[model samples]
Target: MPARDSIDRHIAYWRAEVPGLDPDVEGVVTRMQMLVRHLQRRRTEALGELGLLSWEYDILWQLRAAGPPYQVTPTALAIALDTHPATLTHRLDRLTRAGLVERARDRADRRSVVVVLTDQGHRAWESAIGSQADAEGLLLAPLSESERRTLVRLLRKVVLASEKDGTELMVVPRSVQRPEH
Candidate 1:
């Protein structure tokens, strides 16, 4: 077995299988991993600026951008984020206590509840979003305008492909019911 860092695995694989492959693959992948780590750390810092956790920001952002009324069931958030039902409920409870969101019975179905953002929640979310965008922009500043556009298109294709049918596409104002065991 070759030592982990011995000739780069990416280079070895491509060189062995395909002829005249670009050498940038190893450099790109390694740089991407570094960028991802740095971005995740900056993301945590950015969200914390609004006194919110990563999960908290995700939920609020989902509701706000989810179109008019900006709300969706906990189940929907879970599915979109690939999280569990129990985990989503716990997060909802935390957000509710912070007054960032509220859970109310769905008018059409008494047994069902919807999580809605409050006024304070909206302001907090706006602050978080602005900071995040600024941070991400700075992170990508190294890339030229054309590079940025190309990167965005490539990344979006990968993201959309992975999530295509993983969750309901509808933007709903209601959530799945959670009854105590």
Candidate 2:
């Protein structure tokens, strides 16, 4: 059996102090939250070393996933990132100043603009992505290949079930879709 971690101790303390609590459920949820926080912090630190912020890395990644010519409308990018338009505009401003992204008039709709990744942006994004992958690997190093696969399957089950009512809002990016053999 796997050894108990901090969440195990936490659940024990909570269960003793509050008799009605379900330690199994509480431990799982708490551990999930703690794992997310840890991953986020690790990612932030990794990106920092490359002189990139999380949002910047995210935007570049989305554009990169969009494939060649690497551009998307500001509205589309904002939607994909789950961010407010004003907030995205601010990020775009910073990226533009950093020479990572450029805002250009959209050809199809002259009234609107498109965010395109510059060459420098691609280099920065690639660096950040490599760093992130290394960081994630380090985080998961304790898990064997089989364990990682099982964990991914289980997490997908939970996430998909949780998306029941919100399926319409989900965006299945092309990069994640399986290709034909």
Top candidate by TM-score: 2
lDDT of 2: 0.88
Q: Mind giving the per-residue lDDT tens digits that candidate 1 earns over 10-81?
A: 677877788877666665667678778888898899887778999888888777866656667777778866
Model 2 pairs in collision = none
For candidate 2, lDDT tens digit of each residue in 1-181? 7898999889989889999999888987998899889989988998999899898999998888888778888878878889999999999999999999999987888998889999999999999888878878998999999999999999888888888878743575654344569
Each candidate's TM vs. the true structure? Answer: 0.69, 0.85
Q: TM-score for model 1? A: 0.69
- lDDT agreement with native, every candidate: 0.79, 0.88
Model 1: lDDT of residue 130: 89
